[model samples]
Target: MSHLVRSGAWVAGALVAGVSLAACAADSAPRPIDESSPAPDASEVDYRDGEYAATGWYGSLPSHQDVALTIEDDIVTEVTITTPAEDPTSLQHQQAFADALPGEIVGQQIDVIALDRLAGASGCSEGFMNALAEIKTRARA
Candidate 1:
């Protein structure tokens, strides 16, 4: 019993020390809005240059959104989004997300973009990201 207690103490101390080290190493600095590393050059693009569109559906009620984007030199030069949200609340959130997405994605690489809660709309972001995946697939094809 005494040996067991000693071993438990050792383990607890080890865990505390490990956690302290990790906390010390962690930076409070938030991650950049664009989480990706460097993008490929124009000539090195694996995807073709063109316009593509996709529909993203998300949430329990199955809300969806449509997105159209143009890529030049593997970078998103233009983007358009259409939200078919019927519920007034849903429409407001979706509209807010739609309004903010272009500023976030334009002039950025397609593959590098991953949407978050833009304009305080998480559900809309889910739909938007879902749509972006399809656009990436079509662009790569």
Candidate 2:
């Protein structure tokens, strides 16, 4: 009876080993690459492609700038900032920031766009970034 049980156990072990070998052979077989799925770079971006606009206000005096941006392929293709500067000094700073804006952001990825002390306008940079956050929200995919 003991011999019979031992032989049965050996047979079960043999069956398990056979199954494992079959599985290993299946794993080693070449599988065709799935080309149906889009490549990571070609996949849809989280932010939708389109023109977006937002108004951001900053400073103790609370100046405002209207930010408009065009996004294609998750990158900023164009940008415009309309500063309703109430004073000449503020207008000069805003204009400086606006002039520097296109070069800095036009070719940048939208998700990573931010500025600090651009064109010597620290306050304008702050307002621009604040507006960009809103633009990102509007452009969310």
Candidate 3:
């Protein structure tokens, strides 16, 4: 009976040690980020051919802007901007700004450096630039 109790205690100790080691191993393993999470900032982006998107806000009113870019051979083939504003006037302004983006942005390399405001979309432009940086980070091959 004493021998049986001793053997049981030894087994329990071994089981606890095994579980502790497994927990330590799991804690040390690197966890992957979810796909929806924002990408980390990357310098000198080498874009893989795919569509990338990002969102940003600007100014006191804080209009939301979403920018999506389609890349082919490291060149921006298409650019789309969606700005949802609270006020009607703001919406119109944002829409016009979004409309002008393709003309200015298309045919350029994915590395957007100097985005200028056009057609009263200065605030949206700032948001667009911020989103562009995020897009570049995700574009790295």
Candidate 4:
């Protein structure tokens, strides 16, 4: 009937408008930290020495990542990142990230390490940051 068609069109229009608003909001969201800039020193912050681990989720496909950090005298001594990526491409990307992470973070003070992206692993970086925040909380003396 004419009424049914009119209601359907109204519903479709509402759906389109909702999707458009969501897209705009996503576009205006804050961007990740820039890797090129120098990170501020965290040497002054006191940290309890121990191994800390945290899990984080990232990407549209929602990959889960775990990061473990070993701290000694408030400095990071070792770093381990694990990503259980079933897809071959995802595995490769995660492996590259893992390979590059140690050199980027090891021997640095925990507070100064700002890891957002490395070795083309942007999505995993978000999860890494989240895990790092947890580690920081545990590290507080």
Candidate 5:
């Protein structure tokens, strides 16, 4: 019985250590928002006049969201969000997006737009950022 107990303790310790290491590695990974990395620009659009989908996460949380972005002449004209948000009460994101989206994409390149600004969005902002990232990655592909 003592041997079994010791084995179980060792297993649990190993599992805990493994999880901690994984978490630390993820936290240390390079982020997409690093200022040193070149920003994605709209001019990189080789294909235009189509709708694309993007998916993103809120930091490292399990929460995720999706966005459908329309590109015209390398500019994001329309963004149709497929997933709403984690919370129902916060609808500020939709309104803020309605007000700022057009101006945000005007002269800027499609790839350049980062979720950095939207992180401030009230409820669904993080999800929106993740979705936007996914969309841009897809567009570039």
Candidate 6:
């Protein structure tokens, strides 16, 4: 019926308008970085932490990255990242990779990082893995 058709059109238009308005009101601000955070002290780091290393290779990716993690008494004490190949325009991806792991992993021990369930920036999960691997290697040495 004509009445039903008109009601449907009106409902669709309202939904579209509401969605656009919501998108416009979203916060587009960049996340803040704390440069003042203290560096990991060797004295505080447990050199005898368990050695763990892993590499994440995705597809035919030409580049390589490395991550190292040191765990002492079931706690993560150190993490470092090395990049041999990096995409030029991927700064946000790089930072996300750096910030996601260390702060949380510092006092925890785990066999693997939960990459799939990461809140956002899955693209940098590979980089995070590299850093974890590097920590493992360095700790062993």
Query: Using TM-score as the measure, which candidate wins?
Result: 4
Q: Write the per-residue lDDT of candidate 4 for residues 106-132, one digit (tens) a residue.
A: 888787788778999887676677778
TM-score of each: 0.67, 0.67, 0.64, 0.68, 0.48, 0.44
Give the clash count for model 6: 13
The lDDT of each candidate is: 0.67, 0.68, 0.63, 0.67, 0.47, 0.43
RMSD of 3: 24.7
Error of 4 at 125 (Å): 1.4
lDDT of 2 by residue, 9-93 (tens): 1121110011011112347768788899845652345788877767677787877677777778888887766756868888888
What's each prediction's clash count? 0, 0, 0, 0, 7, 13
Q: Of 2 and 6, which scores higher on lDDT? A: 2
Query: Candidate 1 residues 48-126, lDDT tens each?
Result: 7877767677787877666677777778887767666778888888778877887888899777788778999998887
* Location of the lowest summed lDDT over 10 successive residues in candidate 5: 12-21
Residue 17 displacement in candidate 6 (angstroms): 52
Error of 1 at 84 (Å): 1.0
Q: For candidate 1, what is the total of clashing residue pairs? A: 0
Measured by TM-score, how close is model 4 to the native structure?
0.68
Candidate 3 clashes between residue pairs 3 or more apart in a chain or in different chains: none
Q: Which of candidates 2 and 5 reaches a greater lDDT?
A: 2
Report the C-alpha lDDT of model 6 over 1-141, residue by residue, as the tens digit: 011111011121110111011113667888688779966554454345554444343324433334455566646665543333455534444445555556656565544344542336454564455444444445542
Ranked by TM-score, the better of candidates 3 and 6 is 3
